[model samples]
Target chain A: MSALRRVVRAFPSLLRVGLAEMVAYRAEVIVWILTSTLPLVMLAVWDRVAQDGAVQGFGQGDFARYFAVALVVRQLTGTWVVWELNQQIRTGSLSAALLKPTHPLAWFAAESLATMPIRAVVLIPLIAVIALWRPEMGVGFEPANAPAFVLSVLLAFGVHFLVQTIFGCLAFWLDQSLGLFNVWFAVWALFSGYIAPIALMPDGLRAAVEWLPFRALLGIPVEIGAGLATGPAVWSGLLVQLSWLASCAVLAAFVWRRGVLRYGAVGA
Target chain B: MSGRAFRAILAQWRAAWMAALQYRSNFLADTLVTALWVGWTIVPLWFVFHRAPERLAGWSYDESLLVTGFFMMLQGVLEALIEPNLRGLVEHVRHGTLDFVLLKPVDSQVLVSFGRVVPAKAMLSVGGLVVVLVGIARLPVAPDLGALLVAPVLLMAGLAALYGLWLLVVSTSFWFVRVDNLSYLLTSILDAGRWPMGLYRPALRAILTFVVPVGIMTTWPALALRGLMRPTDVAVSLTIAATMLVTSRLVWRRAVASYTSASS
Candidate 1:
């Protein structure tokens, strides 16, 4: 109870610092968001493929919707905590973070959330382009499922944050966990609907990907945003996403404790 | 081109090689990451093309693979030979280290361009070559000796155009303090080059060919290797490459003249 109170108390300050940092690195943040342009590239290819006829129920219109939403979802939920945590761990700056009363993850979460506004700057133009140019992409609001969509996007953000933090903690033992992250990113590019809509994937592959966290992190919100998954589908997806989130949070906490122990043993 | 400059460039490469050797584990890890990236790119080609009966924007599956190979090879060369150096140019300019590099007897442009060569990163090109060979073997007829000879020449021309494009981006550091973000624009543009330029609309295709020349750097080489390129196309591509190179040199000279050291 006290710990929870403490983190809640620290939130505002942490967020303030995070916002300052974001402003300082505004150009970098824009570049980072812009570099998530693979979806646009994929959109072009998929758009071309759908030119002749629909592929797996995805017409060119559907491709535009899927990829545009995918880009928005990706930019919103993407986590760079692995890179931050890895650098801190490697450089021994984590020791300072450990000295803080609140958990370091709380600070990371604050930093991640704080940068969203700047990231949203990039998304506005995309939203404008999509809204003005390709209004038929069907990315508008659904009042009925709006709650579910928001919940899914929020949970997706949580899931990615936890997953990246878990991977970041691997820096305690590994030479460079970012390399492993590259491997994860490569796989996620295929499975997470960044490259293609999961619905358009082969049956076997789609079935296999459904249970993975990558799909929950990117594909679900995108599906919901596009109005593909609704009612029971959205409910079941939220349940699975919640479970994954819980598992990752527990795992991250466990790893942080163990990593701190190891850090202590090394006398850092 | 002078012997002294050649020795200086060789010494820079030696330093780069030794630095790369020092991080063998990181090198191996990078190699694996790049290989997985290759798979990441190829699987999409299979997913998109296999589902449809028609050629994607006029390129067949095997032909698409050849484009993919050229994309990988060109990207690998840029990653190994060019990116590490050019990506840091903005930083050097910002930190005022470029002033010392300019003060050196060697040509600043040559030193900056040829300074870093990571043998491990070049493994991406080796991997790309394997893909290219596999793509060639998959074709109905092997490339004739003339086509084989033509491929490397076109490949060099493509590389020159790409370097010219990169130089155009990096040269902006003289006026723009935060031009590092500009590199992201370059990569984003190049990502479109992974496929044939014909896949894009006419306007985009023209931009990719004439403005960025990603088509010349990637598609032309792949086409030459596959014996699909025409004499006129090859001549046009070489002309674009030379023009871009000359223009970039002119821009570099102008940018350098205007450079004011950040330390000052």
Candidate 2:
């Protein structure tokens, strides 16, 4: 309880520092932001493929909508915590953070949140463009779906952060957890709908990916944004997302507790 | 190309080799990472082909895989040689170590480009070669001997073009100081090159061909392997490579001249 209180108290200052740090490296951030444009590349490929005829019910317009939504969801929910944590662990600078009364994960969460302003700058314009020009893509500001979309996006961010935290904690046991993170990223790129719509997957692959946390991180929020998810489906998907988030959070905390013990023994 | 410079470069490679040998376990891990990277890139193409009832943008499934294979080879070259060297450039500029590099008797560009090698990353290119061979075997017809001979030359041209592009991107670090993510912009472009160039819109196709030349770097190699490339196409690719090489050299010289050492 006291740790939680301390974190809450420290969050604003951490957020201020994070935002300053992000701005100080704004040139790098701008370059990093372009990495998310891969979906735009996929969009081009799929859009052309669908130009002649629909593929499994996705026409050019559907692909346009799917990839645009993917761009938005991806920008919002992307996590670099694994990389950050892995670096800190490897350098043993994590001890400096360990000395704080507030948890290091809480600081990481704050830094992740700080990047939102810049992300929103890019996202809002995209929302405007989609709303004004390509309304048929169904990405316009619809009031009914707005609440559900917001909730799903939040859960998606949480699930992504917690999952990365769990993986980052693997550094406690491995020489280079970043390698494992790369492996995870490769799998996630396929299953998380970063490359394409999960609905477009073959039934067997789709069935397997749906149960994994990756889908909830990207696919579910994107589906909601496209207005393809609704009512009971929305509620059920949120439940699944929340469940994944809870489990990952628990695993992250458990791993951190054990990992910190190992860190202390190794370093001190 | 002088003997002393060549010997100096060889000595650096020896040092890099010893360093790599000391951390040889990283090779196994790097091999797995390379496989995963290849798989991640290809799976989307597999899904697209599996779900579509017809061919994609006039290319068959196997033809596209050939493009993917070529793209993987380019990525291997990037990861193994280009990215590491360019990253060293960024570190040099940031930490003011470019002074030491400037003091050396050999050409600074050659030293910056080929001085360090991650010997373990040989696995990535080896894996890429395996994929290329597999893609060749899966093709409907064997390539003509002449076309096979031209393919590797064109691939070297492609590598030259990419190195030029990377130089242009990394040269910005002289001014920007902390643009580490700049390499990833090139990477994202390479990612786009994994697909057949014909799949893009005409404007984008033109951009990829003329501006970035990713189309030539990847698609032309695959086309050559399939015995489908024209003589004019090879000429154009070589010209593009030469143009990029000269342009990047000029830009790199100017960028270096503008450098004032870091504040610290």
Candidate 3:
């Protein structure tokens, strides 16, 4: 009860700091969104190819819609905290967070959540563009699926955040955790449907990717948004997402415990 | 004039090298990061080959690997020298550090252009070149001595063109304080340079050559490696690089002239 009370008390201050940092780096955020334009470019190229004939299951319109949805999903879910956490842990500035009464994960979560307003502003326009420009690709706003999609997004964010925090915790052991983070990101890019849909991948690779947690991170939400999966599939994907989220949470907490014990506060 | 510039250049290089050695582990970590990144890039190609097992845009899988390898090399060089140095322009302008750069006796452009060398980035480029050589050995066509000799020259020209393009982007910081995002805008466009330009529609191919010139930095070199370049393309690429370098220099001067320090 006391721990819950402490979190409630610290929430306001945490948010204030997160907002300040976000505003200070507003230009960078804007640049990051603009730079994530690869999907759009790919969309153009793939749409052209699909004009000749459908490539696999995707027609010209489907390609346009899929990749356009990819742009929005990628932007909304992306996090750079692996780099930030690695830097803080390596430099021993993580001690500052440790000194605070609140849980460090809470602080991390707050900081990530604080950036949502700005991202929302960016996403709204993109959602509008997708809706207005690509009408054919629009999923009917089924009330039942809305709850599932929302749940999936929350789970996606949780899985992604926890996984990154785990990577960040590696800085305590290794001198540089960002390298591991890079490899993770490359894998995420390929398996999470950032590069292309898993459906388009070769049979063997696609099968392998399905068994992994990466698809639940970005791909499932995208697929959900496109109305590609429904009913039992959505539930099963969410179950997998929740399982990964739980595992990552456990692993991150375990690493953090060990990492903090060894923490010398050297760089700080 | 040349003597002073030469000394200044050597001093900067020494400083950068020393700074790199201090962070040796970070250097190796970054190199590992680059290798993993290169591997990630290859995965898509691997998948593509698995799907078709045939030539994409008239180039075999091995030939495509050559293109990927060369493109990676060009990218490695950019990340090493130009990208890292110019990346800080926005922060420098915002914080008025541009004034300190201006106060130096050395040319501010040269100082800014050659400021930092991420040692890992150099290693990445070398790793990429190794990949290119490996790909060449696997190819059905054996590149002769002439082609091998021309490779470095073409790579140099590609580097020059890349530097010129980045300078143009960094110079925009003078006008737009938020130009870092614009730099990313450029990067997103450059990502398309990974694939051969011929794979793109003609319209995109034309735009890449004329407007962005990423094609020259990546695709043309790959073509040269495959022994597909005509003398005309080579001459045009070299001319373009020279023209871009001069234009970038002029732009930097003008931008610097308009620089009102952030402190003011």
Candidate 4:
């Protein structure tokens, strides 16, 4: 409880420092944002595939809308904390964060969130251009699912952050944890509806993926935002997603505690 | 090139090889990762084809594998050769450590371009060929003598063009503080080349084919192998690739001159 209080109190200053760090590395931040444009590339391929009439009940508009919403959701939820953790640990710079008064995880959280302003600056124009040029893409607000979509996105961000932190903690012991993370990412890419919509997935894969946490982090919010999910579907997805949030939170706390205990920093 | 220049380049690569040998585990891990990545690259296609529209703009499942195989080979070259060198070039520029490199006796372009290599990453090209063979096995007709001959040529040309494109991206750092993001953006955009060019809308198709030429780099070669490409396309792809190479080299020279322009 006291740790939570310290984290909350320190967060604003942490965020401010993180924002300054982001400004200094603003170009690299743009690169990070641009790399997530994989969704747009997939959008192009799937949009063309859908031109042959509805496959699994998704027309060109449906494909475009799903991917457009997906782009926003991806940018909102994404962070490369795992890669950063690996680099910091390897270079021994993580010692500074360890020396901080607050929990080091608070600083990581701030570092991840501070990139939001730049994302918004870049995405607003992008979304506006898409809205204007391809109104048929229907990149817009969904009033009914809007409130739930917001809640789901925030929870999804929590899941993504915690999951990266859990894997990031692996750097304390592993020679290179990024390789292990790649295996997870490869699975996530397949099951998270990254290449194609989950609705279009084969029956067996869809059935399995629906219960998994992979989709909870990305696909659910995208589905809600694209108007694919209704009242019950949205709530049920949020239910599954909330459980992932809780599970990952517990796992991350445990893993980080264990990893930090064994951590030996060789720094000046 | 003179034998002495050739020897200097060889020595640079040798040093890089010895440096890489210092990290022995990376070789084993990276080779394993490359092999896994080869299989994972096919999974998306598996999902897309799990149902049946039969073809992606007339590309059958086995045929699409040819394109994916070629794309994998290109990524192998990118990781093994292009990215490591470009990264070194950019870091040198950013940190102003480039002065040490500039003081060297050898040609700076050769020094930077062949400056770093990850030989382990080239294992992906070997893995890519296995995929190509797997793709060829399921074909309705075996690849002919001409295809057997032409595929490797296009692969080399595609690699040359890939380096040129990366070189072009890195050249901008000479003027702009950082255009490293542009290289990353180019990489993600090139992800589109994994599919048939016909799978894109016309506007994007033209851009990828000519403007960026990623389609020419990967898909045109695959098409040539299948005997599906026009004879003129071979000439055009080779010509365009050569043109991009020469143009980027010229641009690089001009960019390098600017770096020295202020100091003089």
Task: Give stretches of model 2 more than 4 Å off.
Answer: A126-135, A139-143, A264-268, B22-24, B262-264
Q: Which candidate should be chosen as best, given TM-score against the real structure?
A: 2
DockQ of each: 0.60, 0.75, 0.41, 0.59
Candidate 2 vs candidate 4, DockQ winner: 2
Candidate 1 lDDT tens digits, A1-268 = 8989999999999999999998998877777778888887788788888888888788777888788878888888977899888888887888888889998889999998998898888988876775665577764445577788889989999999988998998888873689788778778888888887888787898889987888888898988887778788988888888998999999988987887776632235
State the lDDT at B111 in candidate 1: 81
Residue-level lDDT of model 3, residues A1-268, one tens digit each, is: 8988999999999999988888888877766766777776666545544555667867666766677767766766666668777788777787887888898778888888777778877777766765675576554434566678778888888888888888888888885878668677778878888767778888888899999989989888777766667888888888888888898889988998898898778666
Instruction: For candidate 2, give the docking quality class from DockQ.
Output: medium
| TM agreement with the true structure for every prediction | 0.91, 0.93, 0.82, 0.91
lDDT by candidate, in order shown: 0.83, 0.83, 0.77, 0.83
| Candidate order (TM-score) | 2, 4, 1, 3
**lDDT per residue as tens, model 4, B1-264:** 566667887887898778777788977777788888899898887877675478878888888898899889888888888898988888888777777778878777777887678888888888888888888888888879888777778777777888888899898888885877788788888888888787877888999877778888778767876788676877887887898889889998897777743233
Please provide the root mean square deviation of candidate 3 (C-alpha atoms, Å). Answer: 4.2
Q: In candidate 1, list every pair of residues with a backbone clash.
A: none
Clashing pairs in 2: none
**How far does residue A58 in candidate 1 sit from its true spot (Å)?**
1.1
lDDT of 2 by residue, B1-264 (tens): 678779998998898888767776776666666666666667888988887645777688888888887887887888778889999999999999898888889888888887877766656666667777888887888888897898899889999999999988888889887666877877887778989998887888899988888899889988899888999999999999999999999999999899897744
Maximum-DockQ candidate: 2
Alpha-carbon deviation at A262 in model 2, angstroms: 2.5
